[model samples]
Structure formats: structure tokens, C-alpha cells
Target: MNTSLKLKLGLLVFLLVLSVVTIVPSFYSATPDWWKKYMAPEGLRLGLDLQGGMHLVLKVDLKKAEENSLELAANDLKDTLSEQSVSAIRTPSVSPDTVIFTLPNTSSIEQVKKLVAEDFPDIDTKIESQEGSFPRIILTLKDAKKDYIKKHSVDQSLEIIRNRIDQFGVAEPVIIRQGEDEIVIQLPGVKDPKRAMKLLGDTAQLEFKLVAEPAGLNLNELIEKAKKSGQWKDGEDLKKLNRALQNQLPSDTTISFEKEVDPQTKVERITPLLLENKTLMTGEMVKDAQVRIGGTFNEPYVSLDLTGRGGKVFGQLTEKNVGRRMAIVLDNNVRSAPVIRERILGGSAQISGTFTHEEASDLAIVLRVGALPAPVDIIQNMTVGASLGQDSINKGLTSGVFGTIMVIGF
Candidate 1:
């Protein structure tokens, strides 16, 4: 080869080698703590078909949300009438905020119309008289309220579901709202498919009750006794209680239930049990949560850092409830119900469990993400064994290498 040609050929060879080496390593670079081996080389999350795991399509129950919304509107109307001294009123039937019912001889159609128009004036009212029958006032939402309800109903539902899934201890889970009322959740490398399904399917609405004050009793001593006896069964009846407790609380305290909800009124009242704002302190308040170090040689523990608000809440709650058992409920199951020894205002907490390093890490991930946006229905679930995924990886690597060599030679 001529001297100049040789130099040019050498440079070309070096450039090709650099591309091959750099490209392959770039494809195999160490992933972030959140996006590890399970992630695709291109920074995109790999689908089940590519990496192999469970893929689920969840159809969110839109009808159920609508029904709940109307029930809320109806309850609001009942309360408004009761407060206004309207007697002999029955529970109203609702269709998206149109409350339909008859008042007894005490109230006339005009009086009811005026009542609704003045008090619950957000909705439209139509008063009609029936011969030999009591007059009726039909209250429905205005166009603006209807549009807002239609817009936010799905979004709120999705948020609650997302919160539940994030607490489920699934690593690298993908939950997305699909159509108007459908959700899709992808769990990668999950060993227990049923566990994932159960967690995602759960409606993990949380409540904080004033553990009814023991009369003239030593709270600290009683808490200690309860702790020793292990009487607080955190997981046993939460699901049952959640379902049965609906619509039972007083109107002022019932956050999730309403007798008459309308798109026009959008009367959403926070239950007394909930914080005044009706928002729960979430895991996003956690800056970071990781496995703790330096216990027994192989012992596992989880350490957490809370955001400012979370730190304040955790600190205050722990301070006042010292010696009392506070249940750390995730997805409505008591993950840990440790006795608060003192205020944990330092924005950090440590939870010790009989877990492996991997298990502790997984739990940290679960607690860190907090909750999902909506309830997810797992329409499909498939578990691929580790060996199967490995086989696919082998085949994929072989095909890639063969194609590369063929391209080079040709």
C-alpha cells in the first residue's frame, strides 16, 4: 500500500473499532438505581415482549366512579335541605347530579326550587307540578360543571390507583392510563405475579382514627400492653372495613361517600378523619429511601428520608403518639406497626425487617414511590421464568453478533 493510503486505511480501521467498542459499551452502561438491568439499552423502558415479564391491561371502572360522583351530589343536597330546616325530605335519586325526588306536603315545588336555586345554586333547577301529586324540582349540573366533572373524574380515579401500585413493592413498574377508563400496568421481572395483581387491584384508601381515648387510662402502659399482646391485626379486616364503612360516617365526616352528587354542584367534602385538606401525606414526601447498613453481618433494614412536610407530619405524629402503636399502612396493609419511642423529626426513619438485601431494597423502592394514580384492573397476567428470559437474551445476542459479522464481511 502507498504510504498515504496506509495512513488513511489505519485511521479508518481505528474509527471503526472505536465505534464498535463505544457503541457496545454504551448499550451496556451501568443503569441508574431506578433503571437497572431491566431497562433497555436505549434509555427506553423495555416491554415485556423484549425483556419478558408480566403485561396487564386494566380497564378502569368508569361507571363506578360516575355512580359514586352522583351519590356524593345527592348527599350534599340532602344535607343542604336539612340545614335549611326543610323537613319530610327523602333521600334523592341521582343521575350525574340531577337529584329527583318529592318533598312531603310541608314543602311546595316553588319553595324547593328556591331552596335549590339559592343554596345549591351551582346546578340548574327545573320545577314541574303533577296533578294530585307533590311538586318536584329536578336539579342538574350546568354545562361548565359537567365539563369539569367529566375531565377530572378519570384523573382522580387514576391518581388513587397509582398510589396503590407504588406501595406494592414492584420494581420498575409502568402504570399508564390508557383510554377514558382503562389502565395498563407493566411489571418487569416480578417473581410473584399474583402478588403484583393483588397490589395493583387494591383500593388502598387510608384512614387515621383517634384510637378512642381510654378513659382515665395510662396511654403509654396500654400501648405497651397492646404491643406485647400483638392485638393490632393490621391487615386482617382493612379491606372489609373499607367497604363496610362507606356511607356510614356522619355527613360531615364522610369523605368518600355522598347521597346526592351532581356534575353541576361538584360538592366534594373532606371527611373529618382525613386531614382538613383531605390530602394524605404521600411517599413523594420521601427524598430517598434505601437499605440501612451495619446491623448484623447479613441483617437487613430500610432507612428513609422525608420531605419537609413529611418530616413535620412524621415528627409531630410520632411525638404525640409516643409509646402508641402507629400502623404504617401501605396499600391498606400494615407493613410495619412499630411503637413510636420518640419524635422522628429528623426527616429520617429506619425500619428493621427480616429481609435479605434485595428484599429490603425492593421495599425501599415501594415506600419511596408512595401510591399510584388510579385503580388498576389486571386484565391479563403472564409470568416468565428467569430461565426463559435468559434463553431469549442468548438468542438475541447470537442474532445480533451474527448480523454484525455478516455486515462486516459483505
Candidate 2:
């Protein structure tokens, strides 16, 4: 062989080897997860048409998502103000597109002006001068702040919903924001569409609240008090009470009405065991949950394992309040009222209920998913069968082979 030709052949061989080393791994990583069942990494994507699976176009309710975000922000703001000894009048039964509040008499007007500007920069407020001896603060969004709230709030909402879905334990879910205000959730091989919807659609914000026994206080009277004071909406009151029970209290204690002792009694008015604004527990500290059998039966119940801080808190609470009933409230509804039989210092606890194994597992899944910062609206869902996925793989392979053949022929 001529010297130049020999060099050319050597260079070509080296390049071929390099391509095999680099390109092969690229192909492996690019393999569709669905295709992994057949062979491992044959590369490329599977289309819905070829797969014969469901194709869904989800319309993201941007407005709803934004509202959810605002609601969360409002809650956070309310909590913050309450913690600072600044009371906020409960949000009126009006559209969430606009939220309003009244400041407590103890609140400093000048301090509020600075705090409102600093704390809730997104919340544009217009403060009225001492109008007839009563100085009032009006909160409404300016154009720029409204725009900011819309986009950022939607993004945060999408992230939270995505986290919720991923934690659903589905093998390979495709959850992505389709547009500025929309999300696309694809659950391949999901057998139960209804279950998936139920899990995802629920806005579960678990809170631990000290119960307050209405005692002699009439339900109608408390309702009227909530209405008249303008400082407490029923829902807000419920959430606030739960948050107090979960984490805000100084001592690791919880208070529930002695009435909750009878599991059979569904309707009972029981006061929470602890003081207001005290949180003995929160879902944020829970690391994971599973359906497990208790020491008693093969009967199913949810086993909770707390994160480090949560474990410490749970242990302390259990140790301090050994004889009290802790209210396990989910979205303001009591799920279980379990007594502190003993101090649980192991960083794990189980919630027993009138639940089947499946129900326990489902509840476990929900707890494992963590609480969302705000609510979520499921705009769309698509499920792909295994057969359809296989068909997609075959069609994709055929197309690739034909394309390669044509390229070689050329």
C-alpha cells in the first residue's frame, strides 16, 4: 500500500473504534424506558400513534393554578402575620382572584406599611389614611405585581403538582408543563384511571390542630362569631387550628376532646388538647409511609416514618403527652384520633383506622407524597397499555431500519 493510503486506513480504523466507544453508550442512555423490556438500549423515542396508547392534550388551568398559588401565599402570609401578633381578618367569601384583609388594632400602621412592602412584595396594597378615626389597609394587586404573581405562581404550582405525581409510585410517568400555564401528565401502564385521578386531584394539606370544644358554645354562635369578627373564616379557622396542633405549640402536646375516644361516634364536638398557634406536627417532616400490619391484626394501617427533625418532634410530643389524644387531621377533617399509648421514640408511628389493606396503602401513598404548597387541578391524563407500547417499539424499529438501509444505499 502507498504510504498516504496506509495512513488514511489507520486513521479510519481509529475513528471507527472511537465512534464505537462513544456512540454506543449514547445509544444505551437514549433507549426508551419502555423499550428496556425487550432488549436494553436500542435508542430513540416511541410515538403515541405507533404505540396505540391514549393521547391526551391537557389544558392547564393557568387561572386556577395561579389562584392556588395565591391561596398558598395568602395562607403563608396569614400564618406569618399571626405569628407576629398581627391579626388578619379572614378572607371574605369572595373570588380568590382578589383577596382582602383587615389589620388588628394592635398592629402599627407605619410598621405594616413597611412590612407589607417588604414581606409580600407580590401583594400590592393601598393603605387608606385614618378614615373617620379608623385607619384601614386595602390590599389589591397592581398590574406589574399581578403579572409577576401569575407567572411565578403558576410555575410553583406546576413544580408542586409534578412532585405530587412523581411520588404517586408509578413506574414511568411523563409530567411536564406544556406551556406557560399548562401541564401534561402521562401515566403509562396505569391500570386504574379513576384511582390516579382521585390521588392527583385531591388537594390534601394535612395539618395538626388542637381541638377546641364548642362546649356550651353553639355551632350557630361560633359560625356567627366567625362571621362577625371578620377575623376567622370557617376554613381558615380550621386550617389555623390544625397548624397549631401540628407544630406551633411550645410543648410537644396535643389536645382533642375526650369525646373522640369512641371511634364509633362519628359526630362529636371535641376541643383540641393544646393552646392556639402551637404546631406539634406537620407532614413536611415525614420521610415515608407504608401500609403495614400492626401488632394486633393482619388488618392494614399506615406506618409513618418521620425525618430527623420530625422523629425528634414526634418523640418529644409522645413523651410529654403520654396520655392525651392527638388529632390527625387531613385538610381540616379528622382521620384518626389515636391516644399516646406510650412514648414513641423510634421515629416511626402507625395510624390505625377502619381501613382495608388497599385503603391503608392508598393513604400511605398520599402521606409519602408530602403536602403540596397549594391545590392542584388535573387538566388532563393519558394512559398507555403495554401492548400499545410494544407496537410503538416495533414500528419505530422498522422505520429506523428502513432509514438506515436508504442511507447506506445512497
Per-residue lDDT over 234-333 for candidate 2, one digit per residue giving the tens place of the 0 to 100 score: 4464544433333323332333222233335555554434423345677888899888776444566788888999889888878887776666766545
lDDT, each prediction: 0.55, 0.60
**Residue 286 of model 2, lDDT score:** 82
The CA-based lDDT of model 2 is what? 0.60
Candidate 1 structure quality by residue, lDDT tens digits, 1-410? 79999999999999877655444533465535444444323343444655567778776655454444444455567656666666423333534446665676534556666766676645677766667877666666667665565567667656655665566545567777777766677777666676566555654433222222234534334333444665433334432332333343232222111122222455633211211111224455777778886555456678878878878877887777778655444443334445678887788766664555766765665555544433446676666545666577679879999998999899
lDDT score of residue 385 within candidate 1:
47
